[model samples]
Target: MQDPTATARPRKIIHIDMDAFYASVEQRDDPALRGRPVVVAWRGERSVVCAASYEARRFGVRSAMPAVRAERLCPQAVFVPPDFVRYKAVSRQVREIFLRHTELVEPLSLDEAYLDVTAPRSDLPTATAIAEAIRAQIRGETALTASAGVAPNKFLAKIASDWRKPDGLFVLRPHRVEAFLTPLPVERIPGVGKVMLSKLHAVGIRSVGELRQWPREELERLFGSFGGSLYRRARGIDERPVEPDQPVQSISSEDTFARDLPLHALDEAIARLAGKTWQATRRTERIGRTVVLKLKTAQFRTLTRSLTPDRPPASEEELRAIALALRDRVDLPADTLYRLVGVGVSGFRDREEAMTQPPLFE
Candidate 1:
């Protein structure tokens, strides 16, 4: 049989990411913050850095690092509180730019998005030109710099977008994908975190070239379902499309406290976040079966417990109860303290499908 994948036309995708988004926006609005180490975060013992300017990054500051640690790392860094309203306004402007080219824009966050320019509405001659136009438009409109990656697929495009630091652009042509990925570290591929990296290293697979050396079946035997994905990703194969309105799988809200709280003391926090998440879920037409409780220990380790009831939560009280009950599932010691807590629901199904049959209690 002929190669099935080769029959499909290669997609023209672009990944656009703002540079140090929150920090960069602060720097742009305030002349005093420009060219300085800016750290956007809430200052507290438990708070984590949300964004770090390139200057702060040089001092080893990064997002998700504790604010106290970030301060210690970059003592001179200016800390700024996030202004989501302003960020949303700027994000809207960025989206408008994308819509000018193509409606196939999938926003990953307020600061980054994937765009399918395979069939753009603009007069641009090529995908690279479209990327340049988008980047230039963002700089002009938002007064901030953006990096762009033009590639044949989303995975390569995302990696390419980060190839250059603040205010850079890179392209991954179909003809050059193999050579470009061969010598690069396997960690460069998404989902290869520390544990995965260690596992790959133990097998003497350190680079994309080394990963590609393994037979797909053997890799699957080693890492389960993920191994199959790795086999394909190593060869620069990704079939995911840039969906404009990707289905919302879950809605969640989380809070990081000023101090770590023991498991028993988390009831109030869980209740509060459950309310927030419940309100968010009301906007969707889907009902979720799984209620998840997420906790981050003082040591930065994360643990999640989920329960899928026979029926979806029908009320805020029910959502809160499910979230609270999930705490019972955490096998950690009673003394374990968590610095953060979140409540969410997933395993979504359409309202029609979810309500096709009456509840057991009803």
Candidate 2:
């Protein structure tokens, strides 16, 4: 009983992501950190990794790894606590960079965003050119690197963006969509996580090429409501629109360290992280009612604590206190070490004056 007229046509989409966003920014600012294994997080028994430089990634040091474990893998790694405020300032600069290209922009996260540049400024002949120009501008303005993916739809475009990384560009022409997807693993499709992969494997569907071989009816019978979606995606069909001016949801800062520090330094680390979070709030000019602290241990265990303040803290000292208080709540073994720490503010409110107020007498 589906209406044929309701089917949507595909559109051009591009996804752009900063390369190793936080760590890259750190390296860009501090020349000494470049080409070194840099982990942007504090070292302790209750910390988590926020970002890992490519050099660090080579030693199996990944985001969310414990500071102790990361050190075990790469003993010489450098660990630094997060400074979110600076990252947010940089993100705002990146957003302004996007606006110059097209109005149809959808930010997936601070480090990544999607743009519908089918119709772009300056009458660029192709989306690829627009992507190139944007990347160049980012490098010029921020001294940072970004990767771009251009495709016929958002799904494909997002995957393509990560194909060539650390200041690279990849374009998937409409004609090459099927070829590009066929050899890719099913996991490349956004929602095909561990659970979905097992189901597909049980049915001998290991790759996009195999998934494409299933009859629509069989796929529908097996996956039920998700079958049609899977089938269409197998063929690179996506119809999502690029949305602009989505409301801000949260602001946060985190870092993964190269080495674990003693637990006693936790207070100093939290203070630095709090300052960073405050900067992000100022750049976005949004106040939040809730504050969150994230930690990852040396064994890669993750933990979070949050506090909803009666009113948002008006100063960095207040922010640090809330974060340090949350840190005390986490349970760490006497000898445990951490690899990362993060602070975030969410539940935003506007500063603008309201036109009407409720009557107090009522």
Candidate 3:
């Protein structure tokens, strides 16, 4: 039988990402901060960088790095606390610009989004033109730079968006997809993190071309379900549609301590984080059934423990209890030091569905 996928019309997807979003906003608001290194983060030993301007990045500063390390990297950098209210306003303005072209806008975060313009509402004759227009409009209105990528699908478009930094656009026609992906590193594929990259390297698959040569069965046997994704991605296949107004997948709050602490010393932190996560969940009508506890070791190893109780926690205290209890499930040695802890809830269901579902044991 012929492949059904090949019969479908080619999609036009665009990924738009703002450059140094939080830091750029800080600089845009304060003329004095425009040329200097700007780091958006709180002034605390335990704080992590929310965003770093390109000036700071030249000195090895980056988002999510420890604030202390960022200070060491760029001592003269200007540190400013994050202002979500202002950032959110800017994001909304940019998102309005996207909606003017296509209703199929999927926001990845406040700083980036995917737009499916297979049948754009605007008169722009091509996806690339649409991308150019959007980027121009964003720059004109927000006084902030944005990068855009246009391709036949979301995966390639996302990768293309990063090909050029701050105020750039790249287009990947369908005919050029294979050639464009061949020499790229395996880690360039989404979901291929450091551990997955190491595993791929172990199998002598260091590039997309190498990954494409492996038999599907062999890859599946070695990496389970993810191997199938690798097999498809190597060939530039991504069928996920741009889902607009996507529901919340999870809610979480995490903290990195000023200093690493033993596992036994995390009770207070877990409780505090869980409370924050609980407050976030209150905004949604859905119920989250799984409680998850995440830990990052001083050595950078990350692990998570989760429990799906028959009923979801009903209060902040209950969520805190579940999160704290999950620590017992960790199998790490007592001497292991952890630098971060997080609490989260996932496996969400509509309120009615959660209330009406039958028990699993029954």
Candidate 4:
């Protein structure tokens, strides 16, 4: 018999990301918010934007910006708290749409994913077509829009997906990689953040094309192991495979309230999100060993607290209890208000292994 894996061709990878995911969901659910500047987050002293619609973005409102600052930037912007349960439901619907075309679906988050559709079920011959179909299906089914990018590899595909905004699709053909990357700023390269940009600027490397001219030895001297990787990416070379069964690294759920709620009312929000987190774990069917709580104050500062139980919680109630216990670690004033709350489960274990173990009480 022939080796089954040997005959497989190079994969065609596509990345799909929702446009202004939280804010878009809010707008889709409320017809009144359509075409308006929408910011999904609480409004108050400590609140920050969880997501901002394209309309809001025009005025410089952005995710993680203080709600007060966003309002100042776009006074007419409407603020809506995130409805995580609804978002998760829509995410699952999108995933199901992907499964209709290919089984090799790898979710990066609720709003983005990578799909290897080289061998799609439909007669779609190209990754671009697959992405288009997926985006269309998501829009038709949920009334929310998405953008997609198609390329020969994951790195380029992710970049392409962001090239256009709202309901756009971009395809980066293999031969055009270098031309596409050359003119962009060095900061556009993955892993090159503010600090890295300063370091690169010190060397007079300001753009992708400029980085390509640097001697390999010089890059290695400056960035160490990362320098070599950067050199390859600058030239649009990425050999990483499109892994179909990538392990689930983490599961989390967060919500932005319409108004900053008192600290005491957090229990209700946490309870609601804990159930959503449990449902997310069910989709992956992984047993998580740690529970975490995330909070963003109206002031825009973010905080997270986590706990590793002797063993993973077996029920949603148990998860909520653990998450609530972790919440006590936040040093909030008695009158302090919160704009957002989130719950997450991480450090997953195999389902079979988890089931075979003795019960918590036993």
Residue lDDT tens for model 4, 175-282: 677788889899988899888999999989998999989877889998999999888888777777666667776899999888888778899999999999998998
Q: Per-candidate RMSD vs. true structure?
A: 2.6, 7.6, 2.6, 6.7
TM-score between candidate 4 and the true structure: 0.71
Tens digit per residue, CA lDDT, model 2, 1-362:
12111335446678999999999999999999999999998887556688899999999998877677887888899887899999999999999999998989898878999998877865778788889989999999999999999988788899999999878999998778878888999988988888889999999999999999998899999988788888888888777778898766788888766677545566777789899998888877656767888887877678888887656778888988988888887777767777778898876767441112221210
lDDT of 3 by residue, 244-312 (tens): 999888999999898999999999999999999999999999998889999999998999999877788
> What lDDT does model 4 reach?
0.85
Error of 2 at 68 (Å): 3.2
For all candidates, the clash counts are 0, 23, 0, 5
What are the per-residue Cα lDDT tens digits for candidate 1 across 269-307?
A: 999999999999999888887788999998889989887
Which residue pairs in model 3 clash with each other? none
Candidate 2 versus the native: TM-score? 0.67
Q: RMSD (Cα, Å) of candidate 1?
A: 2.6
Model 1: residues with Cα > 4 Å off, grouped in runs: 1-5, 357-362
Q: Against the unseen true structure, what C-alpha lDDT does each candidate score?
A: 0.90, 0.83, 0.92, 0.85
Q: How far off is residue 1 in model 3, in Å?
A: 16
Q: Say which prediction, candidate 1 or candidate 3, comes out ahead on lDDT.
A: 3
